[model samples]
Target: MSTKLNRIDLNLLVYLDALLRERNVTQAAHQLNLSQPAMSNGLRRLRDLFDDPLLVRTSDGMTPTERALELEPQVREVLMNIEQAVQPRSAFAPEQAQRVFRIMASDYAESTLLPAVLGKLRVQAPGLTLDIMTPSDVSFLDVERGKVDMVINRFDSMPQSFHQIHLWNDSFSCLLSPENPVLADFTLENYLQAKHIWVSKTGMGVGVGVDPDDVQRLGWVDSALARLGKKR
Candidate 1:
């Protein structure tokens, strides 16, 4: 707190950590492979920077002062974070890995895609955890921030920065009772004329074109009808 950030020596943190752990100036110097005099100079600089006698002489030996004890865990944690930042990530092996993956999926995909996904995980990565969430529960911001790992569904549009892939080509079917009169004609005109049920749809991802009045997004069947300037 006493020294300006630009004027303080970052190396003092290493010296202070070693000194606190070893509790002896000569021992701390030996741990850092530095001479006793150099270590003492570092302790002086640290004291001036923090305006605290971080370590005080004791009857038995050197002991950390109250301030040094407070800084001990914080300093170790900072050093650990720096080491992790500089280290290369270890190669991942599914069989040995323990990780959590967050996925946003629609009900349709829950029935179709998740079974195989769970099967693979059960066989290869038993230790991994999957948190499958409905599309309504998350947003693109979650994906950008790594809170959500992936979204599986149709995308009307997406940000240019997103990495995308075509999982598979799929088709849809409309069911009707065999005795229905529409079975006699089975044409687009007849189908449009028939009263139909509108089930709620989801997993369309985040898009501006999804508004109900957008015409192009009025569900697959209605969107086709809209292209012909028609509505069911």
Candidate 2:
């Protein structure tokens, strides 16, 4: 049976697919060559039509709830059938295709993921173009707005209607100078007494203006310091 009926937009399905893959509306907009606001409008439409949040944000990144996950396979099957019926081609010939992609990530993510992804692209899709944006203000909503591409961050709370992917996980660690006399031994007392060049953006609170992970990390460090009678 054709699911294209019922006043349903087949295009929305495509958008939904992209949203699922990219986990951010802005990245999906880049994939669809649409504006961010337009993508958001599409997201709103999907949310209303399906009566599901679809995607939600987390401290790390976006996550797909149960409903969205359950729908994924069926949606992909429908989209694939349509593609096969229309194009009947199986291979992506990058040399002949004009493909452009944008991605948004933090400096840390860029350091980790871009090198590998770009290396793969150079071989598989040499003709395709890539534009990467390092996100600031940690507003992944910009990715949804299509001003940015995919966002790479620690998982956190996200609204449904966007898509998300789990690339990897990260953790925090402390560093010290090799020349420090406290280097006599690595001890809790040494760590406490050592001076720390703390780095934090002072303008934002926990979750409002700053990234949640950053705020959490800062708080964790503060707590850790308090345990040792150290002040930041």
Candidate 3:
């Protein structure tokens, strides 16, 4: 048995996992509901016990040292084990839970998905209150800070600390009015040249801007190394 594991409070492992995932002192601290300095103190203790500079700073972000990488899986498993051991096995009875769940999401997500979730909640959790917040730049950060109970938005911006469930993949179709100046059989070049009103996240019209979802869809070229590895 490692003396470090025995001496340190096992609960700190939860914080440790969050720290590793966020790779930033301030973000990890925010997620764990601790002040940045306090989290730094806990990190110092961990560094001393592990005898390794677990997170190395770089231009882009923090990179875990070899020792930190080795310990990552063990730390995750132990924390999950502890969580399961203490958690009650009883199912969630929504009617009995008078909890208010705040959700932050995009307008499109609210229009498409939240209606079903809200309908279910209305039928099952009549006592529960819901407050929905519109999506903004820092929605994921809100989740990390526990300002919102949940969020539904583009996955690219989501931090690793929160668990994500893939709801659905929606497809996009290009639309044109019958009276448009372009030919009916619009080629790629013509489509590119067509000027149109762009919708902004703030519900304002813009010159033209690519939505994050469109960017994600069009930019999914797998890495060369990934392709090679898959072939082998």
lDDT of 3 by residue, 1-232 (tens): 8974578876567667877878898999998899999888888878887888888899989888989877876786577678889999999888899878888887878899878888998888988887888875444545654568888776655545568898888865667788887767687557656774454555533223534334332332212223443210
- Candidates' lDDT values, in order? 0.81, 0.73, 0.71
TM-score of each: 0.56, 0.47, 0.56
Q: Which runs of model 1 end up more than 4 angstroms from their true locations?
A: 1-89, 201-217
CA shift of 166, model 2, Å: 2.6
TM-score of 2: 0.47
Candidate 3 displacement at residue 83 in angstroms: 3.0
**Number of the candidate with higher TM-score, 2 or 3:** 3
Model 1 Cα lDDT, one tens digit per residue, 80-103: 678889889987799998889899
Going through the candidates in order, what is the number of backbone clashes in each?
0, 28, 0
> Number of clashes in model 2?
28
- Write down the lDDT that model 3 would get: 0.71
Expressed as tens digits, the lDDT of each residue in 41-155 for candidate 2 is 9988888878998988898677887898777656766886798799956787766667677776667788888899889878877887877765555465454444455667655
